[model samples]
Target: MLIRDYAEIFPEWVKLAKVACVIPVSSVPAERGFSLQNRIKTAQRSRLGEGRVTRRMHIASSRDTLDTFDFNSAAARFTAAKYRKK
Candidate 1:
């Protein structure tokens, strides 16, 4: 559908009929998953361990809505708790 929408902009070598728009649609879900992973690894929390990072990332990515996750507040609390022990 996307290819058909932007057929004009596509390279001339790509035959319109032969062009398959399968990747983008399939990748959107994976892209969203990666986006959730990135949000968990922002500048402030870049030093987080892989195990904890992956656990939080999985939860954040699987949820239907990010609003319910409250990652920012949780991350802040986590940071505070860790720092208090230092």
Candidate 2:
């Protein structure tokens, strides 16, 4: 019933709703943590203890900066600095 009358009775509301949109955000960091765990616990190194594995995983994930680290620029800058020091 509500669905059928949504456009007729709530015409203004529908128009306002149509003009706006919604988006969902999520924590990609948490997903990266799980991925790190799997990679760390692979066949050859499956004997790792839970606590040590969790700590290592957390450190690795936390170091993954979303911005601020540009590998190419950093490498160029490092090379330039080293060359100047000579």
lDDT of 1 by residue, 1-86 (tens): 53467567765635644645333546777887788888888899989999989899876657657666678888999999999999
RMSD of each: 12.2, 10.5
Question: Against the true structure, candidate 1 has what lDDT?
Answer: 0.75
**Candidate 1 structure, TM-score to reference:** 0.40
> Per-residue lDDT of 19-86 in model 2, one digit per residue for the tens?
65343267686787778899988898889899989888876766768576689987999999999999
Best by TM-score: 1
> Which stretch of 10 consecutive residues in model 1 shows the poorest summed lDDT?
16-25
lDDT over C-alpha atoms for residue 32 of model 1: 76
Q: How far in Å is the alpha carbon of 62 misplaced in model 1?
A: 4.2
RMSD over all Cα atoms, model 2 = 10.5
